[model samples]
Target chain A: SQTIHQWPATLVQPVGSPLSLECTVEGTSNPNLYWYRQAAGRGLQLLFYSVGIGQISSEVPQNLSASRPQDRQFILSSKKLLLSDSGFYLCAWTRQGGDGYTFGSGTRLTVV
Target chain B: QQQVKQSPQSLIVQKGGISIINCAYENTAFDYFPWYQQFPGKGPALLIAIRPDVSEKKEGRFTISFNKSAKQFSLHIMDSQPGDSATYFCAASPPNNNDMRFGAGTRLTVKP
Candidate 1:
């Protein structure tokens, strides 16, 4: 079975600070990875997706960026965080030609 | 532009009742329609999915109805339980498209 692990499960960052969230999938190789953010009471916004190592696609321009450093490892980072950056961040992975995605537990980021 | 649209931003249903959520898409090329369920602080999980070639697909208590001509789809939950309370999102993707577009989520509360 495939499993995705994301951490820290919860984060509290001060405004203007840097941010880093990591997600790694086990039991799958060459899976497509995605990063999504959900604001309170709002729909999810796609931030980035990676098809392969060193290949990242940006969906919406914002303060965040994503990277696929390894085949199974994906990282979401920001040089400086903003108050608006606070939200529930999710990591998802899907096999090539798969019907749907399998998601991680998620990271609750609170930028104060 | 938003390709997918979901209705009923919030829904409250009594236990043993039926809960229905609707979603419409503008893209005719979308061949896959999926519904995801998310809890308060967790990533959205794949609930049920239907392909355009099929009119309806059922899994346990959940069902997805797809309309190819209208480019619309819906999720229905039978005998709703409190555990079914969560946010639900509708998503669509073309056969060759790697990215899936998700609709604004609907928060469903099944009260026991």
Candidate 2:
């Protein structure tokens, strides 16, 4: 069974602080990883996706960046957070020919 | 061309009734359509999915109806329960495309 792990279930940080959210998958290799942000009462916005290590594609221009250093390890980071950067961050993974994605528990980030 | 639009930002239904959510996309390249369910503090989970080749697919109490000509798809939950109250998102995956487009989402509340 494949499982995804995301850390810091809830986070509260002051504005301008650095941010780091990590996600990793077990029981799968070379899986495509994705990062998405969802505001309260809104749909999800794709932020970044990676097909392989050191290969990340950003969907929107924003204050966030994603990295895939290891095969199953993905990280979302920001040099400085803004009040608008607060939302629910989710990590998902799918194989090349997979039909759907498996998502992590998610990180609720509050930029205070 | 990559956006998936959903309808009825929020909905309220009685238990044992039916819950339906619709989604539309303009991209014909999208071959996979999936619906995800998310609770208050949890990440979205894949509820059901249907490919363009199939007009409809059902699993348990969840069913996906895909209309290829209309480029629209819908999810139907029968005998809805209070525990089924959650936010639902529709997403599309284009063939050979690394990213998936997600709809705005619909919040469904089933009152017992």
Candidate 3:
């Protein structure tokens, strides 16, 4: 059974503060990983995706960046956060050539 | 521009009634269509999926109907319940493409 973990469950950061959100998967290796952001009462927006370690693709250019430090560890970071950067951040993984996606619990960040 | 389009931005249905959400895509290369269910402050979960090769696929109370000719797909929930009240997202992906495009999402409220 594959599972994804993301933390912290909720975050409150001041504007211009640095931010880091981590996600990890167990029971799978070399899986496709993705980062998404969802505005309140809105839809999911693709932020970044990685096919392998050190390979990250940005769907929308923003203040956020993603990195794959290990085979199953992914990190989302920002040097300076803005008020608009507050949203629910999600991490998801799927096997290569797979049908379904498994998503993490998500991180709700509120930029103050 | 959003690659996938979904309708009925929000829905309200009574329990035991049917809940239907529709999605359409313009990309002919998209062969896989999937639906996701999301609860407040949580990540979305894969609800059901269907391939263009099959017009309809059913699992439990969830059903996905794909119309290849119309470039449309829909999710139907029979005997809707309050527990089924959540936001639903529709997504489409081309073969070998790990980046799946998601719809704007529909908020379904199944009243008890």
Candidate 4:
């Protein structure tokens, strides 16, 4: 069975501070990984997705970026945090040409 | 058309009742429909899914009804319980595409 791990279940960051959230999947190789952000009223929105190492696609341009350093490791980072950047961040993985996705526990970041 | 429209931003239901959420899409290329459930401060998980080849698919108390011609699909939760109270999202994906489009999400509350 595959499992995903996300660090810092909850985070509080000052505006203009740097942000880094890491997610890694176990038991899968070269899986399709995605980063999503869920707002209070808005549903989950795709922020970024990576098909392979060094390949990332941004669904919506904002103060965020994603990188797949290793086949199973994905990281979401921001040069500086913004008040609007606060939300529930999630990491998900699915097999290529697969049916469903498996998501991590998620991290709740609050920008104060 | 890459958008998915969902209805009933929020719902309130009594325990033991049935809960239904609907979604529609304009992309005929989307053949895979999935539903996800998310609890407060948690990541969304796949609840149920179906393909256009089938009109309906059920897993335990959850069911997904897909209307291929209408380009619509819905999620049904039978015997709703307080534990089932969460936000539900409908998503559609094209077989050849790597990205999936998610609905706005419906917040369901089951009063116990």
First chain TM-score for all predictions: 0.98, 0.98, 0.99, 0.97
Task: Put down candidate 3 lDDT per residue, A1-112, tens digits, no spaces.
Answer: 8899999999999999999999999999899999999999999899999999999999999999999999999999999999999999999999988877889999999999
A86 Cα displacement, candidate 2 (Å): 0.6
Question: Over 4 Å off in model 3, which ranges?
Answer: none
Docking quality category of candidate 3 according to DockQ thresholds: high
Per-model clash counts, in order, read: 0, 0, 0, 0
Candidate with best DockQ: 3
- DockQ rank order: 3, 2, 4, 1
* Candidate 2 local lDDT, B32-100, one digit each (tens): 899999989999999988888889999999999999999899999999999999999999988864768
DockQ of each: 0.76, 0.78, 0.83, 0.77
| Model 4 lDDT at residue B75 | 90
Off by over 4 Å in 1: none
Cα error, candidate 1, residue A60 (Å): 1.2
Residues B1-112 of candidate 3 have per-residue lDDT tens digits of 6999999899999999999999999989998899999999899999989888899999999999889999999999999999999999999998885969999999999999
**Lowest summed lDDT over 10 consecutive residues: which window, candidate 4 chain A?**
A38-47
Q: Which ten residues in a row have the lowest lDDT in candidate 4 chain B?
A: B92-101
Per-prediction CA RMSD (Å): 1.0, 1.2, 0.7, 1.2
Query: Could you give candidate 4's per-residue lDDT for residues B12-112 as a string of tens digits?
Result: 99999999999999888888889999888888889888989999999999999888888888999999999999999999889954778899999999999
lDDT of 2 by residue, A10-111 (tens): 999999999999999999999999999988888888899999999999889989889999999999999999999999999999996777888899999999
For model 4 the local lDDT of residue A31 reads 90
